[model samples]
Target: MYTLAVCAEMVFRDLPIEERARRLHDAGFQVEIWDWTRHDLAALERTGAVFSSMTGYIRGSLTDEDDAAELLRTAEESVKAAALLGCPRLNLHGTGLDGRGLPVDPVAGEATGPMWIAAHRTLGRVAELGESAGVVFTLENLNTAVDHPGVPFAKAADTLALVAAVNRPGLKMNLDLYHAQIGEGNLIELVRRAHGLGLIGEIQVADVPGRCEPGTGEIAYPAVARALADLGYDGTVAMEAWASGDDDLALDRFRTAFTV
Candidate 1:
């Protein structure tokens, strides 16, 4: 069966982390946290909710030298935090071009060859640390056109190439389908390619036009879910969308759509 992990940070923002964990556990879903530092580890543990994945300690440009160094350090700290929380995966993003540590317009001076090389070097080091800590690091792709304008690594192919270049056993791709749909429309093809290469570490979903529940958008999530199942993707498929109405109802639709 496909495992589902809900982004508590987005879905249950009003509730305490502990309460979110308990509610998710009761609702039969795993939890994905964006920032582990904001949560109470002990409280999360008490609920016994499985932590599907979390954002990396540092969320900035891996292309810049100074930021890359800080990213490595943050990764080491994140490894310790993951161990403490019993989480196995950490997700990362390529902040922007030139390491300004913020999302930059992709149109304004795209990432160059040197930036790619720097990313490989930085991620390679982080992957090494993750390997020893029993944690895997996943580089995620964001949509630069709308939600995350100017961020680098917005394409699945480019991010996967980075993972391949890093060539670390602990580093893989976190394919967020919503962003992929906006940035690149060929979702199924990308998923197939990533799965065939064993590059996909995790998957997150929403729909286009609005980052809301699946059925409310144009993306056919049921088909996507079935495709993933056909590819034998056993990793967590996280629900990282906004709910328009009843939260529980939104979750029910998510489960129904993806439960292959």
Candidate 2:
């Protein structure tokens, strides 16, 4: 009942990215990626894979004045990269994440009032960029308690607040359930709340604890799938987790989990 995609960055690790894209394509799924700059865009374009989304900027923060400007500049460049792959939704974060997936300069505990204010202003400008470029930008949530400790606006609730505050058609929430299950417990209600507002551009998923494929951990994805279907949410639900075992089998489980 929804478009399915798998993150190439998380799956099929042994193959080249182009091949990974092709593999997902051949397996009847669109592909998602992180950091378009690291790949040869020409090769990716040649893979004939329908891309769902990619990281929207190279380096910048939503809460910094200078970095916000850099975010806008680099985001414009990211739009060009997305064009090559026909990716319609570009992903964003509160700040630039390092190679280790840690925030460049984290906001310990809570961000200052000025930081939130700056983020709002920066995201407003980011929405303008998305509007003019004809691409939607999705601000993703991360769990500070686990994978991404100390990142500002890392909670799903905080992200929802910011995206709702911006309230632009060009900007929307990525609404990752994996992170949400860690940071916030109510998946069905969160989906309902975000969907009810028309604020969700995509829903990313993985089972909790291990960050592995569905059915390999604690999340009841089939129920989540049914909830999305019940809400008439027909947008993308992408797998953004590593395989627990054989990659193909992992893909199979992911498909079955969402097979409502």
Q: Which candidate has the top score in TM-score? A: 2
How well does each candidate superpose onto the true structure, as a TM-score?
Answer: 0.94, 0.99
- Candidate 2: tens digits of C-alpha lDDT, residues 37-69: 999999999999999999999998988899889
Cα deviation in Å at residue 201, candidate 2?
0.4
Candidate 2: RMSD to truth: 0.7
Q: Rate the local accuracy (lDDT) of all candidates.
A: 0.82, 0.94
Q: Residue 54's C-alpha lDDT in candidate 1?
A: 81
Q: What's the alpha carbon RMSD for model 1?
A: 2.6
Worst 10 residues of 2 by lDDT: 103-112
Worst 10 residues of 1 by lDDT: 96-105
Scored by lDDT, model 1 comes in at 0.82
Q: Write the per-residue lDDT of candidate 1 for residues 47-74, one digit (tens) a residue.
A: 8888889877654467778877877887
The pairs that clash in candidate 2 are none
